[model samples]
Target: MSDLVYEILQLAGILAFAISGALVGVRRRLDLLGVVVVGAFTGVGGGIVRDMLLGVHPPVSFVHWPNLAVAIGGSLVVFFVHPGITRIRHFEVVFDAFGLGLFSANGAATALEAGQTPLTAILVGTITAIGGGVIRDVLVNTVPGVLTRELYAVSALFGAGIAVGIEGLGGDAWLASIVGGAAAIVLRLTSVARGWHLPKPRFTDERAATQE
Candidate 1:
């Protein structure tokens, strides 16, 4: 795809992700400032980290005013509008899944553009997809979705891996992103619909007592 389209996709994905993060802040009853902070963090935290690791000085967030603007703007809208765009019964979960898929694709692409190996690209992509949510959960005093749900990280990993695989196969970057995003979205949606979960380690009464 053209650079123009890629840039647009990147921005749109970031804005969508920011809105989801802001919703989380709203659900937690945070103030407007907190909403903006969480939204911006969620939108750009992973990309920033990935760029830093890849030695992309300043990262796109610093160089691109629109990226920051969209994030903050999305947060503002979410703060004042609440769930402005949806009346779905599971709007939060749906949007969170959308953001996860979007960011996973974007992150993986960014890693490859930075000349990272396929494995590293996928890892960076996974981090990019989940890092913001992790930070948001930490701020809100809850375990991240990935820590509690096996499917969350797995979904991201699948998407990132697909992106890396496609790029390695010499496919178009945009096409690769779509494939990766679809894989992530399908995995997450399926898991949610099916109530799939990773098992937690079992502890016997004796084991618990011994630990205590």
Candidate 2:
């Protein structure tokens, strides 16, 4: 994708995740400072991790003022306008889905640009999509959504795989990004609406009898 488009996607992802984190902070009854802190972490923590893993010194989120500005601005807006925002049903879920999609696509694309293999790019993209949420949930002492929620990381992986596949096939980067992101958003929303979940092993209720 073009640099401008990539930056725009990054900004959108940052704002979306920031709003979700700020909302969680408000729900947790954190003070304004705490809210902003949570918001900033949730917005940029994943990107920082991704950049660090890619060996990008200083990380883009730190050097780019607009990224931090957008994150803080999103939190400030949420702090001031939370009353109306909270009234919207599933507000957090919606924003989280958007952020997941955007981050997954952008992360995979960036990894490819950094010359990562497809599998590595997919893994990096999945991490980039969910790492911030994991941090946010840990800060609030809750289980991370990727561990318990419906297909969260799975959705990110799917999106990242699509992006990697498209790029491997010589498709346009921007088109790959859009398609990958849309795929993630659609899968995540559908899973949420339909209560789809990954299956876990269940132990048998009856125990074996002891030998005489």
Candidate 3:
């Protein structure tokens, strides 16, 4: 993808995630500062983690001031319009899905650009998609959504894998990004609507009691 397109996707992902995080903070009754802080974390946390793992010093989010500016803008908007925003059903899910798709594609593409292996790229992409939300949930003392939500990280993995596969096949980077992101969004939304979940192992009473 062109640098312009990549930057646009990054900004959009930051804004979407920031809005979701700010909403969560508001729901948890955090003050304005706390809401903004949560929003910033959700916007840039994943990217920071990915960059650090890739050995990119200072992280792009820090060097690119617009990323932080857009995140704070999203938080302020949520802060002022939370009443109307909260009235929208599944708002968080919708925004979170968008962020997941964009960030997953971008993250995988970035890792590949940095000469990482396909498997490592996929893992980093999944982490980039979910890391921020994990931090947000922990801040509020809630279980991270990826751990309990329907096919969350799975969706990221699928998306990242698609991006890697497309590039490996010599496809256009933009096409790979678009297809991968769309796949992630569709999978996540479908899972949510259908209440699909990964199967959990059921422990026998005897085993459970023995383990306990």
Candidate with maximal lDDT: 2
Off by over 4 Å in 2: 87-89, 203-212
Q: lDDT-based ranking, best first?
A: 2, 3, 1
Per-model clash counts, in order, read: 0, 0, 0
Q: Residues 1-212, candidate 3: write the lDDT tens digits.
A: 78988888889889988888988888888999999999889988888889998999989898989999999999999989988764543888898898899889888987887899999999998999998889888887899999999999999999999988998899867777778888999999999999999997676675684573
What is the C-alpha local distance difference test score of each model?
A: 0.81, 0.90, 0.88
Per-model TM against the reference? 0.89, 0.93, 0.93
Against the true structure, candidate 2 has what lDDT?
0.90
Ranking by TM-score: 3, 2, 1
Q: Which 10-residue span in candidate 3 carries the lowest summed lDDT?
A: 203-212
User: How does candidate 3 fare on TM-score?
Assistant: 0.93
- Give the higher-lDDT candidate: 2 or 3: 2
| lDDT, candidate 2, 27-78, per-residue tens | 8989999999998899998899899989999999989999999999999998
**CA RMSD per model (angstroms):** 2.5, 3.8, 2.2
Better of 1 and 2 by lDDT: 2
Give the true-structure RMSD of model 2. Answer: 3.8
Q: Which stretches of candidate 3 lie over 4 Å from their true place?
A: 86-89, 203-212
